[model samples]
Target: MPHDIHIVTEAELRDIVTLDLALVDVIERAFAALSEGGVVMPPVLSMDLPQANGEVDVKTAFIPGVESFAIKVSPGFFDNPKIGLPSLNGLMILFSAKTGLVEAVFLDNGYLTDLRTAAAGAVAARQLAPAQVETAGVIGAGVQARLQIEAAHLVRPFSRVLVHARDAEKARACAADLGQRLGVEAEAVADPAALVAKSQLVVTTTPAREPVLMADWLHPGLHITAMGSDQEGKCEIEPAALSRADVYVCDRGSQCAERGELRAALAAGLWDRGTPPELGDVILGRATGRQSESDVTICDLTGTGVQDTAIAAHVRARFPGAGTVIRA
Candidate 1:
């Protein structure tokens, strides 16, 4: 008899997992596993649909000794917002590592991606940001922009937040919403450079093809987490900004060189391959983090398959028997 396959819904995931320190720890462990050579992850499969302003990415990973692995399909239709639909959507397929059997399907509609990405930001902040941060900054007003700041607060106490967006109204609304939710002072800034100047830690979460944050505005004792630009031709920070950082890190150097911020820097001849250590190396004590209080650090995060695997495992652990097991 075949096992009954379990199907988990987005609503259920929302109820079970949250964007907090616990999730951050899970993501951190995933990075440590990667650095320790305990995970098998392949290059992401990506397809671009220029006419529709959309892109699709497929990612997967297997962690040694873990019961299950996950393959996630993520799609982003930038024009969806014009029709009142979400710009991002996706699901994960979980399989038993031992017997190659389908165990569950998480129809999370990209919730896990958002959760893990935010958690990754927090992990970066925890490892590189100054110990005391009163003000944090974000470059976009989308769902990720809000979540990154929320996650950062879990690691550092931020009393205020500054947000910069191309649309002034959207930035103001995002600031207001964040202020209400986190009970902190949140304000909108007209200039991205100004936001970078005022913040001790900054997160860029936009989908822009061009640079939004620049190097000239970056100051010492500041840390940046660039979470956008997971696809080709998308960039949030200028290549020069990366050059200015005393310590430059990436979630994965190979992936970033192909699609993340490092791609642009490498193209510009500003960065060398594998010059910066992977975030996992820092987390695993294989590399140093934040050597001095005045050191500037930048973390370029290109969404990784290990993160999907880790978050999937965590969700399964938290909600056992939530899915219907199906026979293979």
Candidate 2:
């Protein structure tokens, strides 16, 4: 028998899904399921096109008892902005867990990815950040940078935000925009070290192959979430910083060792691949996180397949019947 496959456009999704505590809760539960040990998530399949300054990653997961799963294809072309195009875009194919049949196609064009990634940052902050955060700092002036600040605010309620980037103009623009939109005191900082010195919460959102954050800048009561280093050869934080952290966590230890900030740390002999606790483990009480308010914490997020599946399932539950549907 043929079944109907719904096609939900990005506009439709934008109208319904948003970055809120509710969405963060959904992603949080997904991470819990991941740590609880029944979800089957595979390693990310990635392809790099150095000539075009681009990369693509395919990720998916199957959590037992979830009605649907999602396979997401995400492409990042760093040079696209030169042509007035966004650097990241992709879609998700939702399938039935029982029959392995296509149920819907989400033409989110990277919105869902941005949402889930930012939500994960919030989870990290909520779990490890100090009791009070007056200022937040973000390294990078891109989409993720802005969203990360917003996400961190949801959990920590910081009153000020600092933006740092290689491009000073873009950094100022991002800061100004965020200040107006978030109704907070936002400014562009020329020095990442200065930003880190003042902020209780910091998020690294760049795709730099070199370190943008150094180890010595870390201070007590600070929590850093490095979400940019999600690919091989990409790094944002100094390797020694991981060793300096009082509590070091990652979305997945193995994945981080392969593609995130931990990869560089592992190569430098500063960390043991199996030593770091995963974010889900801390959330599930399987591991400790931030034993003291003054502890310096770091969270390496390489993005996760279970997050895609969880967000996709959430969308499927609320998908309006207005999208185009075709029988397959």
Candidate 3:
């Protein structure tokens, strides 16, 4: 059997494993693969689409190690609720790392991307979070927030889970659903300040253009995973909050500086551009993650194309070209 070049559809990608396993595993593998070397996953290339309410943008990533990385082309047509459709739409292209071959196409439908990002939350929990956190706080009760609740439970096993969203009802619903799934107590917090003040660990998953997280609200021994601000002008966590942190880590400094949560900090003079280390640097033993029990650590994830390649590898390997092929 020659390498069966299979291309999976969006429906197929949705039928994969559960959120905890797929999302967390993809993220963990992405970082691990990067640390092991031979993967060229640069920060994504994106341009703003001002015609589409300024929210719409086109971004593509090329992973040199995978032979084929994902373009990850997506458009944020968030007004789709009235139109009865999804807000985000896109597909992931998995090309053969060898021979520069465009091997397979996986119709991610944004699910794989979400999972990989959630996996980064899990990794942050493992690496940046302290050993004694009993309460966890989540900002933005969306799909990614739900996944973080699941992943954090697997790592922290918090006694209480707190969530805050722009919509209180949605936050309540997410809290209930996450609590039901994780077998823990979950509550919809009044706001970011309330949530951060109560929990030892915090994960933000909003796409707010301004800061939702407050600097004065955080307590000591807090570990923050800023997941929402992966694009320029999209910031959830406040830059000043980072000043209170003892350590700061990022998925990629170059990528984050242009688009991640750190962009706000860099702009506000809240952080030293040369100080925060990349997660790979920490994983590869080139830098440190946590220093003290009293120290605060923040992991800012901007996401990378290598994650798509890593997850695509797992999916492709499992299927082994199990779809119809079109040679073009």
Candidate 4:
């Protein structure tokens, strides 16, 4: 007999969970599973709707350790701002790898996306960030940027947070929100350069098509997470910035090279697909991160399918009794 399908909502998983802690948890288990060599997650197939400026992505991941399989459908409406809607939306489905049975569904499209992306940041910090990174800086005062600050706080107990945005008032507001939430003072910087100067760890989570953080602003003993610009023609950090870093890492360097920050670096001849370690390799202990305190490290995250699978499983366990399940 065939069992019915289950659906879960974003509101049920969590409310205002900080990006750092949840992100770290997702990365730890995901990488550990990857290290064991039984997980296989190919690149996701995605398309964008021009008229709506929305994105639709499909991803599948296989994890043998948990005997689980998952697929996700997510969309992002960049024009949602003008439409007075949110910029992201999506859902996740977890299945039984053993019998190929669908098990749980997560209905929050953008929420899971943000959680996994932030978790990637925490994962990067655990392996690549400097030993004494007490200050954190975030560019783009959007929701993702706010979570970045919180996630880093979980990995490292930072004393100060610096935030920069296209709008001064928005940046200040974001900073104020973080300060109030974390009980740590967040300073709103006038520009990216100022935030980059004082903070050893920087996270960029904007939707800019051009570069936001410049190369000259970076210094040694610094680690950066570029979370925005996951698609083609989208870039947040300049190519020169990657060139300045001694180590460069990403969830998938090939995809990132084709679309994300890696694309810009390859174009400027600063680096290419042949360079840097995949974040999975580093987490698996197959590659080294931060050879010394003076070296610069960069983690460019374009997201992967495995993340969607893991988060779907997490959310499903919590919301099993709440969602509707009906046989098709």
Candidate 5:
């Protein structure tokens, strides 16, 4: 038997998949499937290259009824900017669930990953952020920081945005870009605490090994989405902040405990709350979300393979079917 493998370029994928509400819904359904159980997702395979200031991660998931599944390979080199290259890049391979045959190769150059990750932040905001968010703050000036704010605005429209980063120049530039792009007030806040003080929603997108957002900065009606600590040894929020939140959620409790923010919290003996609710459960109404306007909620997103598969399948379905196809 022979099968056709479609080779999709980054341009083709970019044309099909944009970070919009529709893509967010696709990610949302992925989470719903995760909570309903029976989804076979393997633990992430991660490797750190200390000498190169880089890391690589491979992730995949098999949904019971989905026609295809995806395996994604992603690499991040923090010093890529020095060489005029992006810090992150990757591709995804989709295989037929029924036949275990190659279906497509998505050479997205990490664009899909970026979109899905940002959409996950939006999902967290939709379920956890306050009903009316007048001010939104993000603690990072990288690509994720910009996308996260845009994605969140799609769910909870904010009148202003505050940007904070360790680099003052980057923060100012990111703030200006966001303000012009979002058509809203945006400024760079020198202090993380000040940004949190005036924000109803705050997202941490830095790849910091130390805590960037502290427990003391948490205020009422605040929903924090920490998305940078997907790897071990990465900590964006203070360990104690997990315990301090009125309701702390994880994208996946088990994964979070091993590699996400929950890992740090557990090591510090701060996550004694025992089995925190996952984002999927909250989305499905199986658990609680922001109960009151004054509630402080936090969601720890470590990224998931299901998102990769979901987004890949979506692009395939929407594909023009004119890519380079190789039969195997």
Candidate 6:
């Protein structure tokens, strides 16, 4: 007898899965499982193509007690948009943990990645941000920028949002869209410093190879989620800014030290090994989150395989036995 396999299309996924608190909780559980040593996640495999301005990353993980595990391939070609295509696309392959059989394939085209990434930001805010958040800011006007703010609103009731982008028009458009979706007073700002100064919670979602947000702009009680620097040589926040953080957290210390904002800090001799606690540790009660209302914090997210696995399992549960079956 042959087994059945499921194939989830991008449209099918978008119709069902949303960037809401439920998804946030799913990703949160993955982090907790990771911190508890209940997951087997290996280092990410990444390839860079500077000539083409593109990169690809492969990540996977096995969580104890989960029925399935997922392997994800994510590709980012910066030049794709110039040819009228999206810069990001990818898919996830789910396998049965019990027998190693193919279970399903989520052809999400990077939507799952975006959703999990944004959820991680919200999880960071829920655990690390100050109790009261009136104003928020985003450092990039991309898709993730808007999603990050939407996810943040689930954890905190921000009344206003400030967005900054290299392109003034894009920034204004993003601000308007966010304002309508979140029902908040979202506006575009020309200065990154002004956005940072006015926001209690800030999210950076750019792909800059250099620091865009400086340390001098950081204020007391501000929590910054830097999700931009997921690759080597890519930095969105200043190394000095990380040094000023009272609590610096990362999704994974090993990944961060090699490819996240912490990497830049370590290279400059500003940070030492084991300096930044993994976000999982905080969630598992092994470490503290916000020690004081005025404490400054930063969460460096480089993306993890555990997130892919968790989301895959969640989606499979939603649409059980709905795809075509294949004979092996």
lDDT of 1 by residue, 242-308 (tens): 8789888999989988889999998998875356799999998888889988899999999899999
What are the per-residue Cα lDDT tens digits for candidate 5 across 86-107? 9889999999899889899999
Q: Write the per-residue lDDT of candidate 3 for residues 94-162, one digit (tens) a residue.
A: 766565566677766788777777777888888779888889999998899998878877777888899
Give the better candidate number (4 or 6) by lDDT.
6
**lDDT of the structure predicted as candidate 4:** 0.80
lDDT of model 3, residue 152: 77
Better of 2 and 6 by lDDT: 2
lDDT (Cα atoms) of all candidates against the true structure:
0.90, 0.92, 0.76, 0.80, 0.93, 0.92
Angstrom error of the Cα, residue 303, model 6: value is 0.4
List clash counts for every candidate, in order: 10, 0, 4, 3, 0, 0
So what's the TM-score on candidate 1? 0.96
Q: What TM-score would each prediction reach against the true structure?
A: 0.96, 0.96, 0.89, 0.92, 0.96, 0.96
Q: Look at candidate 3 and tell me the lDDT of residue 189.
A: 86
TM-score of 4: 0.92
In terms of lDDT, the best-performing candidate is: 5
Residues 136-192 of candidate 6 have per-residue lDDT tens digits of 999999999999999999999899999999999999999999999999998999999
Candidate 5: C-alpha lDDT = 0.93
Q: Write the per-residue lDDT of candidate 2 for residues 1-328, one digit (tens) a residue.
A: 8999999989988898888998899899999999998899988998988998998999999988789999999998999999999988999999999999999999999999999999999999999999799999999999999999999899899889999999999999999988998899999999999999999999999989999999999999999999999888999999999988999999998899999999999999988535789999999999999988899999999999999998889888866463689898
